[model samples]
Target: MKQTIEQLADVELTENMLKIAKRELREDKCSREQSLEQMRNWVLKHEDLRNVRLDDQFLLRFLRCKKFSVPMAQQTLLKYLNVRRTFPHMSTQLDFLDQKLNDIISSGYIFASPNRDKHGRRVVVINAKGFNPKIYNSSDQARAHFLTYECLMEDQATQICGLVHVGDFSGVTTTHVTNWNPTEFARVFKWSEQSLPLRHKEIHLVNVPATLKWLIDFVKGRVSSKIRNRLTLYTQDKELAKHVDPACLPQELGGQMPLKAIVELWKAELLAKRETILNLDKIALLSDRGILRKSNYSSEKSSNGMNFVSQIESIEGSFRKLEFD
Candidate 1:
């Protein structure tokens, strides 16, 4: 019982001594690290004498001299290195990213997820410890910007394959951007229809301006004179049209996106919408309205071919078996 009480007293005295030591460290006029700024200033203050650049050097020596934490050393490098002009090469970008990754891994931090552009190319922006990488909403926009940079800086050839957007391989649908203004969607749909190819007037006529849903009605169709008009007009917004290609916009839009590769696609959509109004007009025609009106043309071609087809088959069989025998 006496030993236990003595141990408790000793622990309390140790705690009090530690607190006094910490208070002295904080209040000491001769304190080595008075604040974060002071430590950083100490490292940066001696800019004249350096064998290696600040970014590439370790601040351990400087830290010991200034008596600062790791953050102070890091702040010195960050303040200086971040201001340098970026190199104009993908290879360099990749190398810088790899160095960042290695630094994090060495520090025992888990690598987060990395975003890949439509071209399957990844450009890592951040490498903080234990953080997952995220592809944000503006990922596509960032991708386009990257492509533009590659074009301007490297003068590199833009491969068509690289242009393939990663996430939305099938066009970016309305569901992708939920915060999209409904009125803007309607207005853009209206514009795409006018700029979209308007081929096969019979079918394209059904693409009305109301309920923008009808724009999708021309997903597949054959190219006609009108298809160009519809797609081109719909994509008439010059900037957007450049990306969508006004030469071959969907019929509902006004231009054919392309007849060679996308023709079958166009045909399928055309057949789908065939029954809307134009085909309805033809299918509902009354036979008596023309054939029974004593027309000379009707008298000459009087065969519904119900049993007439059977008679024709008999004649065809007679000719076939005679040759076989």
Candidate 2:
């Protein structure tokens, strides 16, 4: 930036670097990189994450970001060059790095993901450090013991391609095998070794929450409905409403977290904060759907309640005043 885009490779940033970047642009002479250096300097001076570490995540996010697509800032060009330099396979689709992150988290392991080269000069190296066994514990005690990432394995051999955050862990990664089979492990390894596509498909979208919800809705549709036939989806299970353990509840509600353990942790966090969560259950009845809507219901069953959309018309007062011939 101090010397313009052409100057960056040769000139290290001096105190005057920003002053040079901020100088008025000449017609077609200045580079986008200089503009980006200015932007970066601005963000560093103005953004919250200015002091944050520039680790893999930082660079991954930085190189793929773009606020616009025209007159292509040299920073964008640099980002493109960095992507090719860092993640060659990803350079073309740098715009959708979030989708790529989903695959890294959802799948238990990814193999042969180049992180460093043979000479170890970072031409590329395999990244399998993400396969920590504890991060994906499918047991209730383990999940709510810390309430990190909860993972459960099933018999079916389906592909899992997404990101899973296990919270901030200041501990070493570990691995374990239960009901272990070398053959199964080999198969798991094979799947992990497969070249993966971006975790999400692209459609013009805005807003992070909406984009995530879209992915969730898409996957939820693919989930076998047989597992969800009995209850309304996503509402907390009343049987364990007072208890937050996954082990005691049905499989769908994070069965990896055991009921007893989860309850204890919730109580601990609550007690630490001096908070109380109300229990709305009685001795004899399980929580029923829409039973709470009774107070809002019409006095004479006029069908004016909140769930009017799902209500059926009463046939008792049916009158055939024939609008039809």
lDDT of each: 0.27, 0.25
Highest TM-score against the true fold, candidate: 2
Q: Residue 47, candidate 2: how far off, in angstroms?
A: 6.1
TM-score of each: 0.16, 0.20
Per residue, candidate 1 scores C-alpha lDDT tens digits across 129-202 of 12222322222222222222222111111110112111101222233333223333332333223221111111
The digit string of per-residue lDDT tens for model 2 on 1-325 reads 1333234324422333233323422212343444344545543443222232222222212222222222233233232233223322322221212333323333322211111112111110111333354544322112121111101110000001112111111111213222123233222222222212111111111112321343234323423353223112222333332322232232223345433344344333333322111110011111123122224322222225423212212211111211211
Estimate candidate 1's alpha-carbon lDDT, on a 0 to 1 scale: 0.27
Off by over 4 Å in 2: 1-31, 50-64, 67-108, 112-217, 220-325
Error of 2 at 163 (Å): 14
